[model samples]
Each structure stands twice: as C-alpha cells, then as structure tokens.
Target: MSEQRETRQRYNEEFKRQTVKYIQEQTKTVTEIGEELNIPAKTLHSWLAKYRQFEDEPIINTEKVWEQERIIKEQNQQIDDLKEELAILKKAVHIFSNSKK
Candidate 1:
C-alpha cells in the first residue's frame, strides 16, 4: 500500500501583509477577496487576526493609512486628468497648425 500525503500552498509574509492591508481597506468583504484571489475566506480571516494582533498595537494607524491611501488616489486622479487635458491640447495644436499649412 502506498502512503498518501496532503500538500498545502504556502504564501510569503509580504503577500500576507498586503492581503491583510487590503482587507483593512474595507473595499471588499473577506469572502469577496477570497473568491477573487482563490484563497479561502477562513485563511484570509486568520491572516487578518494574526497581523492585526501583532505587538498588541495597531499597524501604522488605520486612520493614517486610510488618509494616505485617499490622498494617493486623489493625486493619481489629478495626474490622469492632467494627462487627458494635455492630450486634448496637443490635438488642438496639431489641428490648428494643419489649418495654417
């Protein structure tokens, strides 16, 4: 008779940290993130628990994290808006220059 063994997938610390951060962001439920990431909801919940409990201290202040994320998102949006505006201006300049030819 042959012995059977079970194999489990392993995730790195960085991946676990990022997953916990994503969970803290509250953008999606654990079940949703689990489904999207192909990880079990129970596993994600466990990671959240372990990471959140580290040193019995809050990791980087949730308020500050959320605020920084919001600021970054806003800055990204502004950059995207400026890029779109520049493209439009370039197109207008090209059209006007062609008209003068």
Candidate 2:
C-alpha cells in the first residue's frame, strides 16, 4: 500500500485582507465567497474575525468593488436574457395551442 501526502495552501497577508474586505462589502455569505474563490469557509471566517478587530480602519479596495459590480451587472443581464427567452417561448406555446384549437 502507498501513502499519499496532502499539501496545504498558503495565502499572503494582502490576499487575506482583501478576501475579508470582500466578505464585508459583498452580499454573499462566507461559504459562497469561499466556494467562488476556492478557499475554505473556515479560513475566510477566521480572516474576517481577525480583521474585525481593526474594524475602525478596514481595508477597502475600489478596484475589487468595481470588478464585483461588473460581474453582478453581467449576471443581471444574463438573467434578463433568460426571462425574455422564456416569455417568447410561452407566447409561442400559447399561439400553437390556439392554432390547434
């Protein structure tokens, strides 16, 4: 039998701080952000708790906030497109049914 070793990941202080800041600014839960970023929720939670100690002088990255906004805008646009497509399909169905009647 062969034994395998798992390697642990290391994150820098700036990355940790930015992640904590993201969690604070975004509406997403810690688990959701962790899944998106491929980080563990527990790690993110710990970073957030550590940063909370200096809540009076929190780090705010404008570029990250803008990036998040762009992503949200794109998602909203995709949702709108899906809704329009659904409406068109429903109308087509209604027309087909009426024609068959």
Candidate 3:
C-alpha cells in the first residue's frame, strides 16, 4: 500500500551498536532483532558474521594505517602547492593585462 511506501526510517550509529550487541549477548535470532529494528534480517546476520571474524583475527596493522594516511597527506599537500602556483599564474595574467592598458 502507499502508506507503507510513505514510511521512512533511519538508524543512528548508537542504535546499530546496541542492536549488534544485543544480538551477540542475548544470542537472539537475527530475524527477531531485524523485525524489532525494522532492518532486514540478512543484513544483521552479515554484520554479526563480520564482527565475529574481526574478533577472531584482529587487525594488527597500525604501521600500515599510518603509512596510508601519510601517503594521502603528501598527495593533498602536493595538490595544494599546485593550486598556489596556479593562483600566481593568474596574478601574472592580470599584471600583463594592466601593463597593456
């Protein structure tokens, strides 16, 4: 019915955290939680499965995360320097225009 289509819902981070935790602690069925939260049951299962895998094999790559962040920062710095140069070139164009007048 059009009434169902008109209904809108959005879940916050805290809501999702609580739901996931409840599913883990209570060992309640995903179908049950999903129905209560109005989210698809399969989505809850996927999140639960992912959380279990992450818990079993935690990421121990602090160095890799730092390296990736460093690379991104360097690229951003280079882009900023290029923009400054472009601004200087624009200023030179205006200078030439004034000289012509």
Top-scoring candidate (TM-score): 2
TM-scores for every candidate against the unseen true structure: 0.45, 0.46, 0.40
Choose 1 or 2, whichever is better by lDDT: 1
Task: Look at candidate 1 and give me any clashing residue pairs.
Answer: none
Candidate 2 is scored at a TM of 0.46
Residue pairs with backbone atoms closer than 3 Å in model 2 (clashes): none
Compute the lDDT of residue 95 as modeled in candidate 2. Answer: 98
Clashes found in each candidate (C-alpha, N, C closer than 3 A):
0, 0, 0
Give per-residue lDDT, candidate 1, residue 80.
100
How well is each residue in 1-101 modelled by candidate 1, as lDDT tens digits?
Answer: 13323446689999999888777766788999999999999999899978864543456888989999999999999999999999999999999999999
| Top-lDDT candidate index | 1
* Tens-digit per-residue lDDT, 1-101, candidate 3: 88887784666667666667777666567798788878898878766665543443337699978998999999999999999999999999999999999
lDDT of 1 at 29: 85
Local distance difference test, candidate 1: 0.86
